[model samples]
Target: MGDGRANNPNSHSNNSSSNKPEWLEQYDVIGKIGEGTYGLVFLAKVKSNRSKPIAIKKFKQSKDGDGVSPTAIREIMLLREISHENVVKLANVHINHADMSLYLAFDYAEHDLYEIIRHHRDKVNQAINPYTVKSLLWQLLNGLNYLHSNWIVHRDLKPSNILVMGDGEEQGVVKIADFGLARIYQAPLKPLSENGVVVTIWYRAPELLLGAKHYTSAVDMWAVGCIFAELLTLKPLFQGQEVKGTPNPFQLDQLDKIFKVLGHPTQEKWPMLVNLPHWQSDLQHIQGHKYETAGLHSVVHLSHKNPAYELLSQMLEYDPRKRLTAAQALEHDYFRMEPLPGCNALVPPQPGEKVVNYPTRPVDTSTDIVGTISLQPSQPVSSGNSVSGGNPGRNGWRNKSWQHSDAARCCTASSSTAADKKERIRNGDDWIPSTTEIEALLSFLI
Candidate 1:
């Protein structure tokens, strides 16, 4: 059934019998916004209502000769049942009859948290306002709480999966987007670990890192803790590199980074830690080593130690049982602090500061609606999970850095001198010379 679709891209015309589904004909393709391992996301506007733009994700065919990808089916099934203001809304679904490709339409978001954070760090040259951070966190938790209460684990909750409305009724609202890795977690089912790996390497929970067979909502809390810390510092709290391979579950280096900051975990601290598969073998190397007693306060530099710090610490607790739930976190004193969390993440600049507006997501008009990046006879289009390898765009561990006393960058205040770039590297800033820098250096030599 999968191989039955027509090879020609132009076969899906309006008058043809093998044309687009009735549901799909309504949207006018704007351009390509993002490309994932399994699908291509398009920014489109509905013909009926041209006022609002929407994001249409077109899923590729199954690799195993199946009619449709199981991952796509799971995403469709779960998203159909779930609905929330803080969650990305699924507007409609359609299947291209010509190729049997599936498309899911969602409300459009102009900016994602990943882009937002990067804009502030590299472009704006300022940290995101605390007010904006609080609002984004509150909304994320609000949506996450809904998913947890419904017994669904999103599994993936990085900044890219978090979308913010551009304008209109939902303008400035943070919506939890992307549910490709999401699954309905119930009492009787296969262990989550059996269903391939979940969550990005950097935002992954400690239990998952230790090779826990079964986990709970606490895994999500651990990720939230990481995200919260990143929001504060504009950097990943535990920026660990992914260990790539087949059947290699233990990421020792990632765990090492965690231990370096939070210290070692003991059975007395987390009773379940001793029961994990990797705990025994992994513990051998770190048993004798002494670790600094660094807490959330050390990594996240805030003005004072208050309820916000307390909440951040509790959310990142090693013991899953001891971690704060999304619901509990909402009630924390951090939220109760003066100047309550607002509904919109776009906080106005204070007096004497100019307003900052971010650039919109870039769209490549060259890519057609069929989402065929390349259709060479020699190279077949592979149908794997849309998950990307290594860091992508301006997001992930490599893009952001640990600033302050930890890692200094001499390039910021200093001139664009070769000495400054060299000093930046010597000062512990792991910045590679960009393409522009290389071009400039070559021109100087000429």
Candidate 2:
């Protein structure tokens, strides 16, 4: 945890890149997934389980001080103990001796919410199906509720951090990942860090960016509002121009952007705005002018942006005291009146229960495809293309042939080992279905 006082003037910024550590030789690299200021994520397979694929995040250790950033280490430790369907599961962490690097293993998701929005921007603009939007929002709120119930505050709540498991039908199984900036809020005692500039710029709550020393879960609620607006318009709601030198915002300029589209808040509606730590002093100067004409055009620039525009305005209110809580937001008229489809779908049945209402399958599994094994009622299957005919009741999930393509086989040949299999399976590589198989599975689930 940070000690409240800023670190030494010479401490390295978290954004700088460092040398790759040597201990990375244990696994064979497949490809790169994404890169950020602190680390690089690689698509890798454990040597023991040639069929399994995992995403490994390799972090650069400090040379003279603590090896891994304390914030990064704290996130890993916290996530390791949390097990939720909506939260990203942390598989394992290892310290590489070669260059003293820290590697974290996690489930590899197909794409994040950001990619989905970017890809479907046109579709969303034409007319977003209320059901689909409701489903996504419900999952996002559920994930946030789980985190808050566990006392975890996801300081950074942006689209990029919310990952989707399957395509379309299986779409709403959102997993909240990237806990490097998350922290547990303890009361009565002062927080370890006072630097409120934590979340991504656009999703940042007004209080934090203005240097509020103490905050609560409401900060995250504010971010959720930003995300909700983004989902509606297929564009970011509070994105402001980035300042060059200072990390903090000098004025509430982004709030002005939001008000321009939604209309200025009146004292009667937002009585608490004047009490905010960073309330604007020049409100009278722009009070009578049409906010939209004052260089504050909406990104979509739609003429009929009514209900969505109104709801987004309320969510992005500058006053944290007036912002909607997760539970309250869940009950808003937008979600209540026109709820998204599949928001109330039956939760997946527990082990041993029959899947009675299964959706239609695209491809018949009765006929086996090359390199793919036919699933049996019950059996213990190995990674090899071949399957063992074990007792029907031995292990319920055994009959499924763990498929491995030539690409996976080649990567596994070099690092095959029992330890590697255990590590890879624990990290979620074993659960990834082949792309062809995933399409078929989507047909059954969507």
Candidate 3:
């Protein structure tokens, strides 16, 4: 069970093996979309009245263990219980009898925030426009608020886990995905870590990194603060080196950056700081020393950065106790000041509703598409469409192969085949477009 694999061992073989499950036989597997530490993502189509497309994550059980990794199972279980526009929806989960593997289905998204930021570095650097930065931070705060409201702490809150759904007009509809390291808080005084390290190093809060036993939602707020800074700088706010004394080293440089930008922390201002787990030991060397702030007074200061200096300062506070909550952050001056234009806008359909076909089999139309789009458990639809001989429904479109000729593009709800190809390249997926392409696109769009 501890092995980094799925619950079913045989799923590692070719999907076309004769022993495949009957329900899975109908879906035509396209090329792989992504491969992770424990599973593979495939673009697939369902055979139904209205063929639909979907993304399926297939997990192969460890050869020496029972089933899928517990982490994957936990994500499925948690996501299945939560529903929000800002959170990725888990459509379905299937277990293959032949190999005992688990397959999780989800709505397909175009690009991840990490790729977008990395690609648009130049545009971000030339001038950290207030609108673009505010919009991104606003959406991020909105998503975090929704999650925290539900008591779900996304331990891993980083750019890579934040995905973008639409383009241009629909740019701000971000969805927070990947819940493998998430947890539900049942008590306010609960400890943070469950066992092994949870969050990624870069976005980890100081308390968590210092091994705090009892933590709260503030940990996530800190990560979001880090993300906010990254959005402005187009670079990680905390790029500590893995080893000390090298060109780079793991230290509290991010704290220094924050103080430099917002002014030094006074004991009276952040009284709890000295009590933090490693505060005394870690700061022993820097004690009494006048540290030169890194980004202080620079033209790239938060005063000119997106979201405003005051708002950013509250979020990046050294004292977790004084940090702004996600809900409070959403009400901060940055979002309230300009209020990201059209923040609630949805992605519009292309000129016309034209169906684009992928190599996979058509979708099943009798099934409920809307219901499947939610992570909540599916309610029985009385449409009389049985899995064996049913129509998939109006939204039935097989999840197209992520490797199709047009895999590099983005598609509106109504996009032509030609438009699909163009959309793919425009989304920066073509041959894994370089970072420059992203910068160029951002420059044009922003």
Candidates in order, TM-scores: namely 0.77, 0.61, 0.65
lDDT string for model 2 (1-446, tens) is: 11111121111122135222222334455666666877667766556665355677767556686767876777887887788877887776755333345668876565666866665574333434445556667777777888887788888889989876643444447788888888888652445245435787678776665556677777888787778767667878867765545645544566555566556656676575555455554445434445543222255343334555455555666567777666666666666554333532223323452222222212233322111211111222222223434456666665544554565675577467756876887898676656978778888765
Give the per-residue lDDT of model 1 (tens digit) for 196-242: 87898888998888888788888888988998888888888898888
Tell me the whole-model lDDT of each prediction, alpha carbons only: 0.78, 0.60, 0.62
Q: Which of 1 and 3 is the better model by lDDT?
A: 1
Deviation from truth (RMSD, Å), model 3: 22.2
lDDT of 2 at 260: 66
* Candidate rank order under lDDT: 1, 3, 2
Per-candidate alpha-carbon RMSD to the true structure: 25.4, 21.3, 22.2
Quote the positional error of residue 79 for candidate 3 in Å: 0.5
Model 2 lDDT, full chain set:
0.60
For residues 1-446, what per-residue lDDT tens digits would candidate 3 score against the true structure?
11122223333333344443445555665546666776667767666624455578777555665556878777887888888877887877775443445678776665666765675574333433456567667777788898888888888889878876643434447778888878887753335465456666677776655546667778888788778777766787776544345322345664444445546556787786566555666665345556555353252354545456666667766667888899998787666664353352232233342322112222344333222222222232232223353345645356546567665454433367667778887886674645868878888765
State, as a TM-score between 0 and 1, how close model 3 is to the true structure. 0.65
Q: Give the C-alpha miss distance for residue 47 in model 3, angstroms.
A: 4.3
